[model samples]
Target: MGVPFEDFKFNRQILNAIADAGYTEATPIQQKAIPPILNGQDVMGIAQTGTGKTAAYVLPLIMKLKYAQGENPRALIVSPTRELAMQIEENIKTFAKYTDLRVVVLYGGLGPKTQIEQVNRGVDIIVTTPGRFMDIYLAGHIVTKTLQVLVLDEADKMMDMGFMPQINRILEVVPVKRQNLLFSATMSDKVHSLSANFLEFPTVIEVTPQATPAQTVNQHLYFVPNVKTKINLLKKLLDAEDDVKKLIIFCKTRTSAEDVYKFLLRKYGENGVKVLHANKGQNTRINSINAFKADEVKILVATDVAARGIDVSDVSHVINFDVPVVIEDYVHRIGRTGRAYQSGEAITFCTPAEEYYLDKIQKLIKQTIPVSDIPADVFVEATGFDERQEQAREIDLQKRKENPDFKGAFHEKKTLTQRKKFDAAKAKKTGQQTDKRNKSPKAYRKKR
Candidate 1:
């Protein structure tokens, strides 16, 4: 057991809500972050995904803002994505269940009419994506003067999405004397810069190394030759692994996610499977996530962008249908499982073309993923000629990125063949001209 929640000296309402949520003990991040935040100190928190980071800050924020305030928000939480904003808002509501605090989540996908109305009605905490927050603030819907606490959740993701300018603007608009908090799964240079500018004499807390996977997650990798072989392997694993009760499959592209979702839908029917991607309507994505969280759906296929801020617990496994090109996302993807101290598995399928990214992921995670041999019972399909060439081309591109002077194998060979043809043509053209000149009277006389 970790540190008990009661040791922090919370009010009866917050403690009751914690008990209702079945959270008896605080995780490492919670233990370190809750105290400093409650003391009204600027804080920078670094931890991997699923480390109970949300509760670490949310619980304290609830304790501070015990009752509902005026129409304006007293606290603000900035998120990189609308999905993440909603997830944070859900956590706030879950913990603030017994309190009178009012929370509103603002995002860009839906019409602002309802969000504007929500703000007009009273709000204590505002969780919003940067763009939507700026839009509402500019439209005179948000009153930043009342804000006392400002939290930037998933700060690294905000940097990745290039929200720095909006963040700066937000810092300017909010009252300068307020408390600041920044939380991230990974601490990149960009995050460092944001922290330097966003905080002052702040408490810096890092529970684990940046981008480290949770210890509760058992990672397994398989080398797939192609898409068909990956599907074959996925089918075999799903059929054999009885423990894969709830799973999230991450695909590199929306198209791939849809294809995988369709396959799973055929097998499990509509009730068991759902797909989420940027192309999906906001309602569809939210519904898919809600269904998965409620245990109504057994599997969810999603692209990385659409999968952000998914806080579902008890997910048995996370399968990477395609290796993520963004190496940092590998941590986030696998971190979906093994949540709330539950033991879970993270299985990755790496095609030959994706091996370059797999290598990077291993390096970033500071450990090699255990490779599992394909079962003898499962058929390993042959890689097609075109697919093989594409894989080779992708590998060449990966190499080229590492060494700019390095010419790709296929392109280098084609260049040599073209050079020979060009030289031969030039020689033939000179010879033809010499022969024509010799046939002329003056040239014939000289030749004789």
Candidate 2:
């Protein structure tokens, strides 16, 4: 009942496409961003994932470039990852369905022969990753002169992935007169610099505060003792909630992701669970995401690589199997659930060491996560000695990062247990063996 899609000044072709996509209402981002975009203003949109941010810019881009014109692309969208590039391509196709516009997606991890062929045929809009786009452009396959509009989606993620050099190179090639749109869920210092350099007194649109989780998401935290107890808590929570029809459990590493996937596979059967990580083949990752989106898979175990771009509906919950070492990734991981104005749950499991990161995440998001009591029925496994030592070491490192003056716990303990100075000068002068601790202080002082 907010602003409807028809209220926007879209053409019949776009209107029909929107209707066919079953999108009746305009999300907050769409409502605020579309008009400025349609006016051809350089806009910087700040919105969270699943707030219909992709379509917010895509719709206006399609409206501006109504039909196919030449062999080269008129507009370009540079995404941080291949998954996001593919998602943007799908959105463009969905909205530009009625028009004769030709759009193609280019990404690495596969041969570019097909993409090069698509461009040769005729492409009005190109959606691609920064690295692959640069690769094709350097090879003389892309025409920068034809690009009238350029969008950098998930600019923060791109910055995190170290795509700034390529982005700068792209800026150098593209015409400066063209419209520039940059969108991101969070605004880091790097993003601010990019905006200052890239945008030309542009209008800034922020639907939500930077790094804030969506209002639709209810978050919970649990302090788990060890990896074994974390798994137990995960099982207990899943077994208790029948409403968790679809969920994603995010781990920090590929090994942990695989282990969680295997555990879920045993519990839910092969067809019910899938795993996605960088190590998985591109086709396998695509299929896994597609299945999850289609509701064919009830669970997806993934690393942070899958966190930024994969958008699935009705995700009942997102479980953080491990707290991300990168503080910014915390926002992206939980952003997976509670998408598209749907209410969802995000639960995080933190070990003693991970609490350091958890504190940083809370400060970034500007909110304290509610801690939930572990279920009485679940067994809380005791931490092994080695694991305990590792956790202590990690926590010490984290503390040192915060305050360089902080000598870590181990440093302090070592200082206490360190052997007293051997007093080599005294040994040389007195001709006494001072290195041995077994020699009594009285004997050493009494003389050789």
TM-score: model 1 vs. ground truth: 0.91
Candidates in order, TM-scores: namely 0.91, 0.91
Error of 1 at 149 (Å): 0.9
Off by over 4 Å in 2: 412-448
Give Cα-based local distance difference scores for all models.
Answer: 0.90, 0.90
Where does model 1 exceed 4 Å of error?
413-448
- lDDT score for candidate 2 against the true structure: 0.90
Compose the digit string of candidate 2's lDDT tens values, residues 214-234.
888999999999999999999
